[model samples]
Target: MSDGERRDMGSKLSFGRGRPGRTAVTLPDCDVPLAEMPSPSLLRDDLPLPEMSQPEIVRYFTNLACLNYSVDTGFYPLGSCSMKYNPKLHEDLARLSGFAQVHPLQPIETVQGALALMHELQGFLAEITGMHAVSLAPAAGAHGELTSILTVRAYLEHRGESRHKVLVPDSAHGTNLATVSTAGFQCLPIASDARGNTDLAALAEALDEDVAALMLTLPNTLGLFDQNIVQIAQMVHETGAQLYCDGANLNALLGQVKIGDLGFDVVQMNLHKTFSTPHGGGGPGAGPVAVKAHLAPFLPSPFVGQAANGAYVFEEPEHSIGKVGAFHGNFGIMVRAYAYIRSLGAPGLREVSENAVLNANYLLACLREAYDLPYERRCLHEVVFSGSRQRAKGVHTSDVAKRLIDYGFHPPTVYFPLIVDEALMIEPTETESKETLDAFCEAMLVIAREAEEEPELLRSAPHDAPLRRLDEAAAARHPVLRWQREDQA
Candidate 1:
């Protein structure tokens, strides 16, 4: 379109807040401030950047943030991803004077408050998870998994046992499989039984001297808590292997059961998930891994330890896994998590888990009949519904997801928990009210009916969005990371 036409549209009431699309600029003629800042090399010219006025830049980003849906803005029912409302109180507390301004290189004595908070957080997390110690050193959940695996490996290596494989349930998080592989252990999938729980028979068969650990996500990706979990842990123990609980779904069981009491020798919780910290594109996350007393020494340093003089200090573990990240965890994320923990206390946390489970079950009722739920049983904090019925009617899970946009709600996670064909995974967090869930259910059921009555509407969905479905294959094959035009001399 012509610049005049673009400018005309952008001057409207609604569009006035948005910027015109990026206008590519040629080098040497660039009008950005960086264009005047010369390169370090004497012979080189100044760096060229596209020139954008303040208003244009503001409008451009405003439009971009609107493109995204978050727990802060809407109901994000991404199962296993616990996109719960990040309490604003936690954000406020995290940024308090003492917490936010701490320097990483400052002497331990100088940052006593920061150190004490970390020490208390460690103790609180340990008590919550029923572990001997906590290491708020891993940057994110997956990083925590890596840290746990390394610790398990160290414990095994110390005993002169060289285990080669880590048993991963088929229902386990994809990251678990990847983590084990990256940590130099083979990921052996233990298939699920008819009950949507890990197949005890398969796990028993997979168990052997070579298996170092069995990574179990209690309420597996299907959101079904394995009833045989305790027995499964025992079986792993019998085989002389550690039990690693992927506590991503711990939100579903908080205050209900403790994984430590359930026989998880090493476990990692996505503090960003269960503890109500922010989660998104790139984190500021804390994924503190707790371990049975035996694995404590191998934890990442420097763990917060209480000194004799009533001061908290960073002390290295006996057989440390070294530093997981540059400093002690994501300090900012830890602050948020610590705030969440203190605010919710013990019983309050349990209620959060209970309410989360109740919400999921409530949402599931509205969907179970219209959609095909592979496992028709009590779910935890999330439920997985299949779009196989819709797919038969010529609408896919992806199409159904896009159509949800019209209802002013973010779509549930689609095509996940791989076992279910055309899966739509939903998690209505504890914070959501019954009304929001009912609306979500209504939107889902309406979409289900439309899939049958007007397959075309369901097929060519997301009619409201500025962008529509591109040929995904072509887009991926020739990804346009950024916009470009013919070279200008």
Candidate 2:
């Protein structure tokens, strides 16, 4: 089949449609005594198994892979998501038999080497964040928030206090509010000032004995580092509340600053984001939560520690939050993160953050004229721009995003933080070279001009892509998750 025909016919090729009487594998007759067959009711009638020759199967998947996009393939300037290039070296180290083949159920005495890695990783994370201890239990950034919130509840209960509120900035990640609600706490929104910093007055009024924690994203959703973070932490601490730092933007501060020193009582690090692990597509993530000495007692148990014999062992905290995950939490991801840290020592990690900030600022400067920058200040790893300029020309933010697809690039985040009129959040991670940045900027410039000169092109974009604009609402509401005979035309 030709490429154009394949694209026009839809990328999903049902495995057995084109070929009949084809099989990739052939099973041999049973060599041992066979057991009695199970009941028909217990067996599935239709397994929907794909039947195809080996070559056909490989080609089908290869074609589908080409249709998809990933960080390995192109520039993914996803803001707040930190879709940076994960080093292949980390992948190699993570796949080593010593790390990859070990089962979690093995005795601690036998897996001392793995335990040692985890113990050293814990210490490295704690030292990096200026925390006393770390727990590699939570599975993702949002899960980390939930774990921290639960710990706060436990700490407040231990103090015999009834604090039930959590303060979050208006520009905070939406996950913060959801996490607070899930933890059975009232979430109050603190407004951002005109300069995109957290409104100090609003935060002051919000802080009270009833507030359990103040959840702040250091460099918030808009990618602006809160200038008054120290003051905010002090205020929250004075009111008998803990300060929880969402370490999602740690990419912008990697080796430059530590959260614990900045007065945060608890923090959660995204191993997949800042530390370079394969992430996205709702996947395998590690969000290790770190805490000060006071809150260390409430951390999740089974943490790796040095035993009296100077050997690593699993140690449980006295007043623990219980197990948040099975086993020791995404060991594969932890391995990748540990590899990343070891590969880049303190100085190299600092350079990572420095280049990230520089790249973001460069993009901001190049595209500020085309897009309206809501907060015209220096940004960290990402920058948020408004699409009101394009909208005025009858091209919405979504239009520009779709047009980017035709330009051979994935779109940056859009319509997020819910504060800007039409937000276009862009994060050019440090992994990208200057040439990629310039190409992306050139695409945006071209799109801006097209929006003015040819509004219709912007409205209906992705002209060169394999697929055109889809009915997103319908797809969401009535998702076709699997292929069936009826779907075959």
Regions more than 4 Å wrong, model 2: 1-3, 6-11, 26-36, 40-50, 480-484, 487-489
Cα RMSD to the true fold for all candidates:
5.0, 2.0
Worst 10 residues of 1 by lDDT: 9-18
User: Pairs clashing in candidate 2?
Assistant: none
Off by over 4 Å in 1: 1-53
For every model in order, what is the number of clashing pairs? 0, 0
Highest TM-score scorer: 2
lDDT, candidate 1, equals: 0.86
Judged by lDDT, which candidate is best? Answer: 2
lDDT of each: 0.86, 0.90
Relative to the unseen true structure, what is the C-alpha lDDT of residue 114 in candidate 2, on a scale of 0 to 100?
Answer: 86
lDDT of 1 by residue, 1-489 (tens): 344433343333332333344443434764655454375556643323445656666666575555566777888888888999988888788888888887899877889988888889999888988999999999999999999999999999988999999999877788998899989999898898888988888888889999999998888889998999889989999989999999899899888888899999999999989998999889877789999999999999999998788888789999897887897778888888888888889999999999999999998887788999898698989999989988988899998998998787888888888888998999888999999999889998899889989988867877766555557899889886753332522
- TM-scores of all predicted structures: 0.91, 0.96
